[model samples]
Target chain A: MLAAAVRLFNERGYDATSMFDIAESLGITKSSVYHHISGKEQLLQMAMDRALDGLFEAADEVRALDVPAPERLERLVRRSVLVLAERFEYVTVLLRVRGNTEAEQHALSRRRDFDTIVTDLVKQAQAEGGVRPDIDPATVARLILGMVNSLTEWYRPRTGGAEAIADALTRIAFEGLRTE
Target chain B: MLAAAVRLFNERGYDATSMFDIAESLGITKSSVYHHISGKEQLLQMAMDRALDGLFEAADEVRALDVPAPERLERLVRRSVLVLAERFEYVTVLLRVRGNTEAEQHALSRRRDFDTIVTDLVKQAQAEGGVRPDIDPATVARLILGMVNSLTEWYRPRTGGAEAIADALTRIAFEGLRTE
Candidate 1:
């Protein structure tokens, strides 16, 4: 049901979609939707949770690892790529969010928290001399995760090589694209 | 008028925004909007053209440069960052397009053309041994431009340092974030 609703929200812009449309798409009555879900915002919260929770879980695990910051950052990027491929619809909706509603505002706040984690990791890496220090750590964090998040836009789960894509991203991000 | 429409479209999803809303936002009558423009879509087209033309013009100039493929790629990335920052609202709208209308489909096609040019440049750089050959050229192009495009999500034109942003992006993209 959440999957069906997210698909509808992603297909038609979330604001354009409503209980009636979601119910119609699911071939159930609107009352059935109301019985299962509080409102469309609840469904949105669930969908975004599916994406954000996956990311935070991965970040938590990465944070616990007793490794250098750059290594931890690499692992986080890889895990994120897999999560994005695994929860493609949810991430799509999450990425499109623009803080128009309470649910969106909550998601945006959580997203900022996630970004701060990456920024801290960048700072740690720079402090340890594993990452370059010239660029602002916040900017570096945004660009690196920005590359990872772009996967939600074009990556197809059916194509099924999240590991390879993650590897490619980490390689280019850390090693530079120019030949050594 | 186009600026007002683009701003509204960016704030409100394009589908949810109406000509009346645009007119009201601009403190003009709906007919006044129709008189100046054919409709909302013509405005969208003009706004998108503002972004796409800037990119293609930059690409044309980069193509004429007698430099190595990697050098051309770096120049293109720098110039694209400038174009994106210069036409901030237009690029935001351009990136959000999802092919729901004739105008949007046209914009998507032009965007694909631009992507193809970047992909070809990546391939040329790989063939010239200027870029690493391990990763797919298309993926490399997407990831690199994806980093640049992410600026629209968080970049504030009011902060006013496009040159510094461009330099930071180029350094991270080409030299990467890891210290040698």
Candidate 2:
């Protein structure tokens, strides 16, 4: 039911989709849909939680490592890519969020918290002489993660393995495309 | 009028927005809007054209430059960043397009053509021994431009100059964020 709701939310904008539409799509009564969740808002919150929780869990694991910031950043990127692949629909919906509702605003705030984690890591990497310091840490964090987030747009999990994509991303990200 | 339409489309999803809402947003009657354009679809086409044309123009300029493939690729990236900064709104809408309509499908096709240009550049650079050959050209192209297209989500032109962003991107993209 949640998957069907998310699918509808992704295809039709969240604001445009209603509880009745979700019910009809599922071939179930709207009250039965209500039995599972209070409203579509709850469904949205649950969907976003799936994506955010996966990301935060990855962050938690990477943070526990005693490795250098750059290495941790790389691992986080790879793990996040796996999370994105695993929870494709939820992440897609999360990325499309515009923060109009309370649930969306909450998700947006969590996303900011995630960005701060990346930014702090970038600053640490720069201090450790792994990342370049000339550019702002915030910009570096955004661009690097932006590349990862772009996967949600074009990446199809069935087409290729997330591991290969992650390897390609980290290689391009840290070493760049230029041949030494 | 088209600008207002694009703004509305960006705020509200294109499928959800109506000609009436657009006319109301502009403080004009729907018929008056029709006087200028046949329908909202035309406005969408015009807006997408603004972004696609600018990008293609930059590509054409870079194609004429007598430089190595990698340098040409760098120049195209820089120029494309400027185009995104200049036509921020249109590009934002263009990036959000999921090919729901005829205009969107046309825009998506043009976007693919643009990607092919970048992919070809990547291939040429690899053949010239400037770019790393291990990674696939198409993946490299997507990741590079994906970082750029992300500017639409967080980049506010008023915050900083596009040149600085371009320089930072190319530097990170070429030499990478890591310091030797």
Candidate 3:
């Protein structure tokens, strides 16, 4: 039911969808949707939460490990690809949210939390003299995240498995896009 | 008038913006806008074209230069930043266009032309043996473009100039975030 709602919301857009459309898709009464959860906004929030939580949790585990910053960055990329593939729909919805709704507000906050983790990693790498010091931490954070997030815009499972996509990202980002 | 129109289209949405609103913002009659342009769609398309043309032209000039791959890449990044910043509003509208309209279809074709130019640069860099060998050209292309394209979402010019941003992106991407 939740998946159906997300699909509908994505197709018609969040603002255009109604409880009636969701209930019809589920072949249940509108009241039944109420019984399952508070309402549409809550459902949207939960969907976003599911996607956002995976990112934050994966980032945390990667941060906790005792690996080199490069390897840790690689692992972070790999895990993100896996999570994005596994929960593609939910994450896609989360990306599309523009902070217009209540659920979107929370998602943005969670996004910032994830960003903080990446910022710390960049700083650590810079301190160790691997990363560049000339650029601001926040800008690098945005660039890295933007590269990964662009995956949602066009990447499909048909290109390769989650792992391959992750590996490609890591290689290109670290080694530059030249023949060496 | 143009700035107001771009803001309304970006915020409320392109489809939602009407001639009356633009005319009202300019303190002019709706017919005056029609005299300047055929209609709203023309305005949107023209705005996007102006922004995109800057990128295409800059990339062409950078490609023609005799610099090494890495330095050329740095120039590309700096010029891209300047183009985006100088034509901030038009670029913002261009970034947000989802290709949902006929004008957007044209916009996308022009976008593809721009991509083809950048892809050629990636190929040139790879042949020069400055970039890595393991990654595919297409993947790297998307990654680099994605990183730079994301600047449209948050970059403000007064705080930082094109030179700093370009240097930072080039450094992080070429050197990796890992301390070696």
Candidate numbers sorted by lDDT from highest down: 2, 1, 3
Candidate 1 per-residue lDDT over residues B60-119, each given as its tens digit: 999999999999999999999999999999999999998989989999999989999999
lDDT (10s digit) by residue, model 2, range A68-162: 98889889988988899899999999999999998999999999999999999888988988778999999898988898899988999788688
Error of 1 at A140 (Å): 0.6
- Give the per-residue lDDT of model 3 (tens digit) for A35-148: 988888987998899899899889989989998775676678678778887888788888878898766887998888887888787777767666556678788888888778
Residue-level error in angstroms, candidate 3, position A84? 2.5
Clashing pairs for model 1 are none
- For model 3, the chain A TM-score is 0.90
DockQ of structure 2: 0.78
* Best model per DockQ: 2
Docking class of 3: medium
Whole-structure CA lDDT of model 2: 0.91
Better model by TM-score, 1 or 2? 1
The sequence of per-residue lDDT tens digits that candidate 1 reaches over residues A79-173 is 88888889999999999898888889999999999999999998998898878889998988888888889987778888998888988888888
lDDT, residue B51, candidate 3: 86
Where in model 2 is the C-alpha error above 4 Å?
Answer: A24-27, B24-28
Task: List all candidate RMSDs to the true structure.
Answer: 1.4, 1.6, 2.5
The runs of at least 3 residues in candidate 3 whose Cα sits more than 4 Å from the true structure, single-residue gaps closed, are A24-35, A68-70, A178-180, B68-74
Ranking by TM-score: 1, 2, 3
Error of 3 at A131 (Å): 3.4
